[model samples]
Target: MREIDTTRVLCSLAELEVTGGRGFAVGEGDWPLRGFVVKTASGVAAYVNLCPHAGHPLNFRPHRFLTSDGNLILCHSHGALFARDSGLCIAGPCAGQSLTAVAIEVVAGYVLLGADVDVERLANDPL
Candidate 1:
């Protein structure tokens, strides 16, 4: 399991001021990856930085993933609108395609991602 150094606690889940705002970028998994953890009044959501449109990072500018209204996750490369709740582009070039979600759990305001995610094992394993 990859160790997470979350000393820079951005904000507590209860202290999230806005909906669909950006969170910390903790390293996870086997490969080098940067994940954006989104926050809302209801709960939190996490997604890989990769965009489904053209295999590019979603955030063009630093810590600016959502639109001005803060309703959807916007791909700056092509202006794709992804729902914050579902992470699916409801309208855009990559419509119907959803962002790959990484499971996360909020513990005492710190978010912990699934570092040792066995993707291949899960795929090969039958229900």
Candidate 2:
């Protein structure tokens, strides 16, 4: 089995407090895995930046992924709202669909991508 790299750090835990969420990228070359992390009631959560509704990136503005109330994930493209912890689309165009989740963990006050995640494959085929 190939070794999974768990050392990919996304951002510091303190950073999520300022904006509620933040975006990140992993891997190299042309197609890197793009994702975001959000602060949730239980802890922290992360997801692929792609919107299931139109296959567009969820955020147009840097680190801006939440709604005005800071209660949900907002897709800037079509106003789709998603649950922070579950990545479930609760409203808008893709009501029944969901954002692809990227596994993550918090360590030493930093958020890191999960070791089991296949960053390259998930980036290219985020279904």
Q: Which candidate is the best by TM-score?
A: 2
Q: Which stretches of model 2 miss by more than 4 angstroms?
A: 1-6
- How do the residues 66-123 of candidate 1 rate in per-residue lDDT, one tens digit apiece? 9888878898889898987778899889999988776766666666665464444432
Model 1 lDDT at residue 62: 67
* Tens digits of lDDT, candidate 2, 1-127: 4333456789999999888999998989977889999999999999998999988998888999999899999999999999998999999999989889898878878898987999989998996
* lDDT, candidate 1, at 41: 44
Please list the residue runs of candidate 1 whose C-alpha ends up more than 4 Å from where it truly belongs after superposition.
1-20, 23-31, 115-127
Clash count, predicted structure 1? 0
TM-score of each: 0.72, 0.93
Tell me each candidate's RMSD, in Å, in order.
Answer: 6.1, 3.7
Residue-level error in angstroms, candidate 2, position 126: 1.0
